[model samples]
Target chain A: MSGTFYGLGVGPGDPELITLKAWRIISHAPVIAYPAANGNESLARKIAAPFIPEDVTELAIPVPMRREREPAQEAYDEAAKLIARHLDDGKDVAFLCEGDPLFYGSFAYLLDRLAGKHPTVIVPGITSITACAAQIGRPLAARNDILKVLPGTLDAERLKQEITGADAVAIMKVGQHFEKIRGVLTELGLAERATIIEKATREDERITRLADVPAGERPYFSTILIYQGSEAW
Target chain B: MSGTFYGLGVGPGDPELITLKAWRIISHAPVIAYPAANGNESLARKIAAPFIPEDVTELAIPVPMRREREPAQEAYDEAAKLIARHLDDGKDVAFLCEGDPLFYGSFAYLLDRLAGKHPTVIVPGITSITACAAQIGRPLAARNDILKVLPGTLDAERLKQEITGADAVAIMKVGQHFEKIRGVLTELGLAERATIIEKATREDERITRLADVPAGERPYFSTILIYQGSEAW
Candidate 1:
């Protein structure tokens, strides 16, 4: 009989943020896998390091750093094959995800490849959006407010249109596109209301006003949360 | 010196989904508070019941069941005053919230009242959005796809406009407005693509297609996740 495949979300950043369910599964899994971009240390693995069994077999899926899709698709394909071999040998494999597995997480790509052939389970984790909101001590959305999560990679015109209709907005992947997103928010007269949080719940977390961040100074692992706070809950 | 106030997110329905951080705080808290409508058992408290120390002082914040704003506002106001008493007596109070405290949670009401007067720390938890996605084994959003979270209470015209722009959508609070929201999704030609998840990660969790649910039948504690698999992510 084949072993089940588990997609475990370790959480946004803080080690203690890992769910009890995820911890319980990670402790007993026979084999484990995690994604490492360009051979860098996997954030998900690091978050789960304290709970993982010392002698468990570890697999690191090396995802390319390129912006193109083909290379990353090939990596997930190759990793799926390796995971399948373990599953075929009747050893359960747990794949660690930094956040919720299917919420823009790399595990989704792996799940798409492996789920059809094997029994799979996904344990959700704390997303960076809520983590950032918690750190800022502000409500992400309350009452009937519509919350929109936009990618910073979107063009300025599109970003403006989305933000215009949203009662609250969270812009993810604010690496190189930080300035463009900030400019759109500024043009929409929301610069004062927006807050940028980098590496939320992590040791090096930084929370700053959008207006305070200097131009061309792109921060990594950042999300911009825009809420007017004018509505009563 | 006054004790610190904490807003702890206990995660979605499943008790095991509680984070180690939240569990840790709940275990050691001198006093615990949770919202309950008309003295009903608090879902947050139920999710956190396992970790709470038996001898710990429990506070039930009685929230009235009303559509009007005045009564609910008064309830929160009174609860905040009572909670302040514990803090003033140098006893730490932990407020339990289901899902992330800031994400459409009632804890936001308490946070606003107590944060300014006391030392407040928010411990983020797994939101139902991600939990529902994990249960359904589907991606919430990937690549640059925009994800919009609309309240089912929104008017049909507004829901249609918002859904039209979003690549992925999660319609929350689908308690009584299921039929109206379903009508909107049908009009948008997204009825086949949407999946409704009720009480995700709980013992009685239910997953049903939007098209399968009968007309005029409203399911409680539900969320509708709509995504088109046409994008290669």
Candidate 2:
């Protein structure tokens, strides 16, 4: 019988935010796989470190930081082949993801490659949207309100239209595109209602108003939440 | 000093899906509060049952089922007073919430009434959006793709507009509004791309394509995920 492959969501930065189901799977899995960007340590591994046994076999897939998709696609293709070997040998392999695996997580690459060929299971975890909302102590959406999750990489015009239409909005991946997103929100007269939470649930988490962030400063691993609901806080 | 208040998300439906942070706080809480719909057992309490100590004081707030806001507001007002009494006595109160508290959760009602008066912490959990996506083995959104979370209670015309604009969409609270949402998705030629995950992560969880569900049959505790991105599954 082929071994089962588990895609575990380690959650958004906080070690303790991982689900009990993920914890159990990570603790006992014979093989562990996670994405590492170039020379940087794997954030998913760091989050799941406490639960991972020291003797477990580690497979770190080196993901390149690039704009084009070919390099990353090749990396996932190679990693899938390596993970497939373990499953063929009847060894369960667990792939750790930073947030809920299917919520903008890189685990999708591997899932796409290995799902049909192997038995698979996915355990969801706390997403950054909820984690950032928790840090700000505000509801993202309530009652009949619509919540929009936009990538900051989107064009300014698209951002403005989405923000204008939604009651609550969470703009993510706000790296260099922070200025563009801020410009759009300001144009829509929503700058005051937006709050940026950087590295939420982490030890060095920072929360700042969109209007207060320094000019030209781009914070990665950050999410900006805008509340335009009836009970805007 | 008054005892701190905690809003813990216990995850969608599975008991084991609760995060380690939520479990820790729940296990050690002196007073645990949860919202119950009239005489219905508190879903949050049931989700966190394993961690809850037998002798822990439980405050079951009776949330009435009504469209009007006053009756529910009054219930929360009364519940807030009782929870405040526990906080005043330096008893740490952990309010259990289903999924993430701020994401269309009733815990927000209590948080609004009590946050300024007490030190509060919110532990995020696995949302139904991610859980449903995980169950169906698909990413909710990936790599700059916009994701919209809409309430099924929204008017059909408004739902059509929102669905048309996003690359990925998750329609929640699909009880009586299932037909309305299905109609919108079908009209947009997205019915084939949609999947309904009912009570994801639970033992009785069911995954049905939009085309397979019977006419006039509505499933509560369900989410409809529609993907229209370039890499749509």
Q: What does DockQ give for each predicted structure?
A: 0.75, 0.71
- B55-121: candidate 2 lDDT, tens digit per residue: 9999988877664333367778898999999999999999999988999888888899899999999
* Best-matching candidate per DockQ: 1
Q: Model 2 — interface RMS deviation?
A: 2.1
Q: What is the per-residue lDDT of model 1 for residues B4-84, given as tens digits with 9 covering 90 to 100?
A: 999998888898899999989999999999988887989999999989899999999897766533347777889999999
Task: List clash counts for every candidate, in order.
Answer: 0, 0
Interface RMSD, in order shown: 1.6, 2.1
Show pairs that collide, candidate 1. none
Task: Enumerate the chain B TM-scores of all models.
Answer: 0.96, 0.96
- How far residue A88's Cα lies from its native spot in candidate 2, in Å, is 1.0
